[model samples]
Target: MKFNVKRKVIMQKNSILFVILSAFTVFMWYFFFVPPPEQSYRQTAQSQNTAAVSESGDNKFKRADLNESDIDNIYVKEEYINIETKQYKAVLTNKGAGVLSWSVKEKNGQWVDLVFPESAPVMANFPSLTYKIISKSDEKIVFEYVSKEGWKITKTYNLSDLYMHNLNISVEKNSKTPFPQIDLKWGPGLGTDSKELKENISLTRALVYTAAKPNKLKKLKDNSEPASLCKWTAIDNRYFLAAFIPENSTDFDKILLSRLDKKHPCSVILKAAEPKDVNKKDYSVNFYLGPKGYKHLRTYDLGLEKTVDFGFFGFLGKIAFSALTFFYKLTHNYGWAVVMLTVIIQILVLPLTLKSFKSSAEMKRMQPVIKDIQTKYKDNPQRLKAEMLNIYKSQKVNPLGGCLPMLLQLPIFWAFFTMLRNAYELRNEGWILWVKDLSAADQFMQFGSFNLNLLPLIMGIGMFFQQRMTTVTSDLSQRKIMYIMPVIFTFMFWSFPSGLVLYWLTNSLISMVEQYFIIKKMRLSS
Candidate 1:
């Protein structure tokens, strides 16, 4: 009696699992998969050689054209002062006192470029366009530039222990000179390392973080209108991000955003406000340049982490990412972390998986008998229906038992997919030899435009095995049709990120193992 009660309780739990999983699967596929925007990033030294000197050639924001061979030759040869932290290294040039390079160090110990000077238009005066370094110290650099009217402006940048910096700008004046609204414009574009500029340009835009939420503005067109207020703004990209956060923006209420040029589809933002009325004449802001790692970005609580978009299944994506990171903390390598996640999820769903596989096998075994019954009652539809029900009851098989459990797990699968596609941490991380950059394709060779991706192929092969291993009961035509799915998915996922392909492939291999043992046990018992 105790065993019977325990059995009923277990059955009820499995029944609930089946209902929820099946419903989620149906809903997900019925609606199709849709995801949301937009971005995340890292800071690295990938300076573009192209230099565009503005038509106005304003001294306040002038850059050496390097168009003339003489200047180009001299520019590269010139020394730019650098400041380094544990996570990043920044190079500041005397040409504009602008950032020449910003490189981030990744887990593989490989340094990559994040700042794309060619596309990025300078915005703020903290590093005033062309300043002489009057004084410097470890983790700090001060730049000075004198206006033609005799106003000496000094911009000091001090590196904090975090992946950020403090910018303090003060103007020295003996006489009252009406200081024009403090205008610092940034953009042209962020650095593009993984993809073509046009392919990623749309993803690069100005982001303003308000008290309520962050707003992504493509271009700020009308300067006459009052600018929206925000705590910070960033130049966002698909995998890298840069933002300027004012230390005190209470007075910085006005903003101007404009298009730089058509060649690069560049966007620029001029964040300005009247500072004369403020108690302190100095302006200060914090600048952050780095990858959009959730754990890394969440430290500041400024909604900066929202840049790492998780799409439609954000709630699930966050949970999945947290799990992935949790495992990463234990395993260190992203590849191993994925494997660990897969193992844990698989174990949790094992009971339902086993129940489904068993049902499928049983259904397959009863197929021969069912086919005979259909023929026996060929013309009698009503009789055939009744006969089929009895046979199922006698055989103690629930026809939906196979599909329900499998369907129940699809939500998790979708969540996992969404998380991996946007997880910035996977960008430069590796799994094994030759499979660097899990966020990208694991392509080993390219012939013309056709590249060979080994993982997807392995995924297809495992899929084929799993397909073959799945006992087919419906019809010979259906079995043949099912064989085509592996081929379809292989090509479809051929160009997908390595991390995604790895997860599917690992799932398939594990499923194949489980199916084999389950089928063997069921057959022996029968």
Candidate 2:
């Protein structure tokens, strides 16, 4: 008495409900993912030759309005220390021995400056000038600063051939008088990704690796996270991540916070808890600032790759995402990589696709018989269902076949959707004419606030034709409603990434061709 229920049939029967669900999912992403600016804590030590920097009470940022007289007497000879490795270029000014600019060659083959602009107060807030440069090498720079209180602070930076560096901070013995606990801060956070500063700030936030697993600091008011002693911390946006992983986190508490100021919301910050006297003076940590490439982050082994949100299909999404990058490398064109990915996936699922459609055809052929049986037992609801099952059993139609193929394909679709949205390789990469920057919405023409994106429109037309090729219900109203779904989806996808829209359009076109042949053979045989 057991019968295989076709879930795809249910979907085809309730197209209106499915359309609403799909559209809602797409709406949510448009709000969550977007881009912002960096800021620094610029207040230098209030008193010269002092290690303590006073925090400003004013929250608003302002520029000093100085004129000719202010600049005329400023004949200060400014000098800076330069460090260059195979991966990045860094300049440190004596102001605080902090980095002025840290530039790295990105996947786009351009040197991207990751430093906060001059507007930020703490852009040069690193390599704390409280320490003085005592030793230097081609790959290593060491600084030692001794306070008036006889407390010595030592900081050493070891450069490498990559975008990562090792930083070690040590303190000389001062058992007589204990030094006041100070914040070891690194800010303003990551640099801007998109031209829109507001969007960048919206996506920028502090991410911490804690015992409760990795969590993003949403509100600046949540002051407890940094004092919670997390293992590591990061400030990242859609494309890049700047992470700090301490060697011995047990010795001190860690806190990661952002100023959340409107001027530069995505500013970087690192405030560690008081240094415990473990009878040790030196502590080590690693700093990584670069693109969050899937393979690159995974190899770091510090859980940096967790920043990539794979959603429900985590493992499957990872595999498919890796394949997408692999195909992109092979074709050298992300547009073609998308096409190739669709083709490869369709080929692999061809058997399931055929099985599902065959089931659909069988049910189509049995519709008349099912109707007659229903009419024969119209008065007996129970008997009607029983007879319908008998008719389905005789015809050997699997109700679940139609849905199984779609369910199998969903993970791949979602994987493409997630990866293409933020892939840095597609940041400014273009496909055909008018389809520029696959990571953004494909706008061929813009009329002020309005845009004419041709891909989603074409994709919608393709969906319409594919629906037309299928058997439409006799009810004219339902058929009209089905046609409206394409229009709804078209508008919903208007703001989605071009790469994703391209994949969908490519998939729809292929489906249209596939259905055409399937129908032709079925007609010829009949």
TM-score of model 2 (CA atoms): 0.75
* Tens digit per residue, CA lDDT, model 2, 152-251: 5566778788867787777654566453333344455456544434455556566777644455323343543543456677777777777777787754
Consecutive 10-residue window with the lowest summed lDDT within model 2: 56-65
Please, what is the whole-model Cα lDDT of each candidate in the order they appear?
A: 0.66, 0.63
Candidate 1 is scored at a TM of: 0.73
Tell me how far the alpha carbon of residue 2 in candidate 2 is from the true structure, in angstroms, after superposition. 9.2
Tens-place lDDT digits, model 1, residues 1-526: 0122234335645654564455456445433432211131112111211221232222233322212332333333334787776787777765555666777776667565655555332533433245677877657888776655446667788887667777777755544554433544455566646432334555566666664433543233343223446667777776777777887776465554444332233333444554553333677778887777888898987778888878677787899899999998998889989988988889999999999998888888888998898788868766777787788788888776887898899888888987898788898788998788798889877899888999999999999889888845555655665676677677767767899999999999899999999889987897
Task: Kindly report which residue stretches of model 2 are placed more than 4 angstroms away from their true locations once superposed.
Answer: 1-15, 28-93, 100-103, 109-144, 180-182, 186-189, 195-202, 209-231, 256-280, 362-394, 398-400, 434-436, 448-451
Q: In TM-score terms, which candidate is top? A: 2
RMSD, every candidate, angstroms? 9.0, 7.2
Candidate that would win on lDDT: 1
